[model samples]
Target: MALNIKIHKADNRGKADYGWLKARYSFSFANYFDPLRERFGVLRVLNDDIIDGGGGFDTHPHNNMEIITIPLKGALEHRDSMGNSSVIREGEIQYMSAGIGVQHSERNFSDSEPINLLQLWIFPKTKNTKPLYDQINLEGKRIQNSIQTIVSPEGGKDIIKINQDAWLSLLNSDAGLKHKYELHKPDNGLFVFVIEGETVIGANIARHRDSVEIKGVEEITLTINAPSKLLLIEVPED
Candidate 1:
């Protein structure tokens, strides 16, 4: 299998800044439209956001989307129309399935501390079912220097469920750690994003916020050039 790979540099992402929120978009979203980056496989939106203290989005509607949020720095207070409310902090991940339709808002949990988070929206395989919410703290569950599966199609004890045949994993690798990641589904593609530090794949290098999209291959190898935090997202090609 030929490994077709493309790198999306950190500086190339679309940027938008409001008074309270600063965001970087990996794909076309909101008013930032890029025909070439409208979507990647089943992955629709990947937003890296920094929210000022006490600021947040008001309730918004969504349907047929599987939304996942990972707090990177601080805590996020999430409330939805489904009567689910929770504060997801660093080391915690949240999932919201907007099956038919749902309204929700996410605000900084602290009034004085800014928050950094990554949010993703993926196209669901089955829609118009039931809206749901789930979250998990990975503080003690994470295995150092290993790929920890956080989200998958099946909602198990540790992993949150998405409405698609996709998977999301995280790796906290030490410098010099060598890793190999294999796709769960042969047809699925992998989106590898460096959350922190540096990573090298073959001749490719990715540092803070940089991402690589690889498809038409079953697996890939990576070397942690620095103590790195990485996010692995796998989804169908079509």
Candidate 2:
């Protein structure tokens, strides 16, 4: 498969610590700029944010974009001007379509526990569709030895839908078994990111926080070496 790719090791990413919040940008942001690390495809930002107890970003404005928040650990109390307010904990996926305009804020509700979350921005297919907010809890998803669908268009099955055709999937290991993770979208490209543990993708090896983009490959196969967690994004190659 001929695919453009980038690998962000856990230690080599751009890190910024601001007392109450610590963040690592997989791609450059604000004053940080790396010509080779701007973004991947329509994926603009992949921010791993760790917010201290009762700390988070205040009201923020965004437009013409799709913002997705995936909490890896702890919980995030979210409030938007669209009349949506909720606590998104681990196993929950949240999406906000800042189509025309949207104002929102995120904060950790716990007084002593920190929150680890992933904030991702994706370019939407349609412009100015209207501001929206939605969240899905995937506590009932099951994928014995493969990846589970967490986000997709139209909120298909057990996935949280976004405004784009892109899809996000997660894989959690069951045991010491070789697993096959397949991307059904052959015309689209697959961005595979390992969240934890080690897994073999095709002939390449990927460890925690590492990723590989595979295009033109009809399917992908993963050999889970241990109890692993993975995230896969399928988006149009164009």
Best by lDDT: 1
Which window of ten consecutive residues has the lowest lDDT sum in model 2? 1-10
TM-score computed on alpha carbons, candidate 1: 0.98
Question: What tens-digit string does per-residue lDDT give for candidate 1 at 22-121?
Answer: 9999999888999999888999999999999999999989999999999999999999999998999999999999999999998999999999999999
As a whole number from 0 to 100, the lDDT of residue 181 in candidate 2 is: 52
**Model 2 TM-score on a 0 to 1 scale:** 0.91
What is residue 130's positional error in candidate 1, in angstroms? 0.5
Q: Whole-model lDDT for model 1 versus the true structure?
A: 0.93
Q: What tens-digit string does per-residue lDDT give for candidate 2 at 91-208? A: 8899898999999999997989999988888888899989988888887665656667877877866577788778888878854667655555667787777778887776677898
lDDT of 2: 0.81
Provide the clashing-pair count of each candidate structure. Answer: 0, 0
TM-score of each: 0.98, 0.91
lDDT (Cα atoms) of all candidates against the true structure:
0.93, 0.81
For model 1, the superposed segments whose C-alpha errors exceed 4 Å read none
